[model samples]
Target: MSSARWIYLDAGRGLAALVVVHHHLMVFFDHEMAALIGDESLLLRAFRGISEWNVTAILFFFFISGWSIFLAVERLGTLNGIGPWRLYLLQRARRILPMFLLSLLWAGGLSWAGERNFNDTSFDVLVGNLLFLDTPASLRGLWFPPFAGNGPLWTLSNEAWYYISLPVFYWAVYSKIANPLVRIDAALLGSFVVGIAAIGVNAILPNPFFLFATLWPLWIAGYVYGTSFGQTPIERRVIFWLGLMALVTWSMALEIRSDTLRILSDGCILALCVVLLVKIVRWQTQLTRLHYIDGIVRLFGSVGRGSYTIYVLHYPLLLFLASSRTELGGLATSLLGMGMLIAIAPHLETRIYAHVNQWFALDRPRADA
Candidate 1:
């Protein structure tokens, strides 16, 4: 990757990391701070609004992930035929499995350390979390999860599912299929139809699994852009404009429909991301330094570089906040928590990942993975 591309990745990854932090903070500390800060305060409402958009941020990250991965495939395809499928899976597992296990253990340990009752339900949660299975619907609210334990692991599972399934997508849509564009179009159309069907079922059945199907478009969109990244500046510009429009339309939809709209909104946002990423790759400029802002972005990026580690360790910290005696102010608590994580991220990457990697036999030197 070019230095410019690294800069773009750093910016997005930093923003994603901070959003993940805020998402956890809102669940753990925001509610407590609301009463303390003033129940009817505008500041509280503002915080609440941002909190509600955490899922949107997560969806954006997924979109970016898709775009990045597709670009990788494109780059590789020109060289050695994109290598072997088994090697790809092994690399992905090495990348994700260490962090996933650590997060699970972090959750289990928090339950023990915080003196939370680890009943039969807790045991089941540990297993479910470890296996990346859907948490029993019964435990959904047993404890607030976003900030507490490995709640973020849910996304990891989705990501893993996507990674594992990519080969099939490549074969079915982009490679083996006689007409790749037609296959892409058909897949997207079928996914949207499925999403609409899920919405219908959700009206009576309330199954959120339906939402998982919606991610197909985002993943495919990312693949398409990634495949085309180095083709030409004009083509890149086309993707960029399309992505921008998708984002604008999605934002407008958010105002129009809160429930069902997110389904389509996310799809549009995913497509928009591909375009935006293509533009970034083609047109690059350095940010004029804004003293503290640059410093903070760099710090966030440093922590984000070990996103896997920070993500794994973050839940335990949340559980600590939820169960501990400290009654921290919202802003103060959030800043402190982030500061600690920023400080600890390097340590986790260095020492903790090693410990977690033992079981998975994933302690390969960072460069190899």
Candidate 2:
């Protein structure tokens, strides 16, 4: 992918992260916000509308994950050798685990300070989260909930599985196909097959991990798009078709009575949105360069680089503030939280991760070889 395309993706990711954060902030402080700004205020109505996009923002994150992982594997030639596989796994762990552990500790400290039971903070729960076994409350007996009620961590489990499954997906589906088009087709077919199988198994056995398999196709859609990047032109007809599908599935999702069907329809909508977003970005980049637009994108791109830290740490901090009975107003509290995120994210997400990578010599040339 071109640097311009990357800049666009980063901007999207950053904006999505902010949306998610804002949604949670509104949710956690709804009473305070209503008391301060009146529930009927136009500003509150707009905030509610923006907050409703959180689910779509999350699905976008999954799409970006697939695209990023595909690019990383391709650059490292991971599929061609065992050495690259080892390095890839280490790199992924380095990127995710340290900050994840830190987030858990942060949550634990908050729970202790507040004397509030956000959720179970037991040893087993901690271990389960570390193993990426976090799942929805509907699957409580089958898997762990996010540690200390940091609900967003559930997606990390899904993403971790996606990372682990990618190499296996390539070996099983992409290795035998010499033609690029055929490989893409086969991968998509495989994703659908696996998704269907997972849904069937979950229906019978009710496993938490099966949710990962059920949503695998969304990730695959992003990977396929990345592989075909720049080669495919943004066509209006393609966008129209995808938009139609998204609309249909979104309508179905709203009306569907069955939880399983509703979830499936929502997934379909998300996958279509991912495709539509890619086309939109491509079309946007094709337009004549505008300095102001480029500057805005670059600003978002900088935020995107620290998005992981912002995501993992925001909830615990919010919980702490909410429990502390601070004198700050709702807007002030929200602004303070965002300010903290801005100040802390760079150090934790990038500088600390890089420092750990250096300490362990994980980025050494010999390690890559």
Best by TM-score: 2
* TM-scores, each model vs. reference: 0.72, 0.88
Cα lDDT tens digits, model 2, 261-341, are 455556557767667665675577678555787788888777776788888888888887777765765457766877779
For residue 39, model 2's alpha carbon misses the true position, in angstroms, by 2.1
Candidate 2 backbone collisions, by pair: none
For candidate 1, the 10 contiguous residues with the lowest summed lDDT are: 138-147
For candidate 2, the lDDT comes to 0.71
lDDT of all predictions: 0.58, 0.71
Q: What's each prediction's clash count?
A: 2, 0
**lDDT tens digits by residue: candidate 1, 218-336:** 65555565555555753444365445546654775656543554645665665665466545634553344346645665765675566656655776766655656555544565567
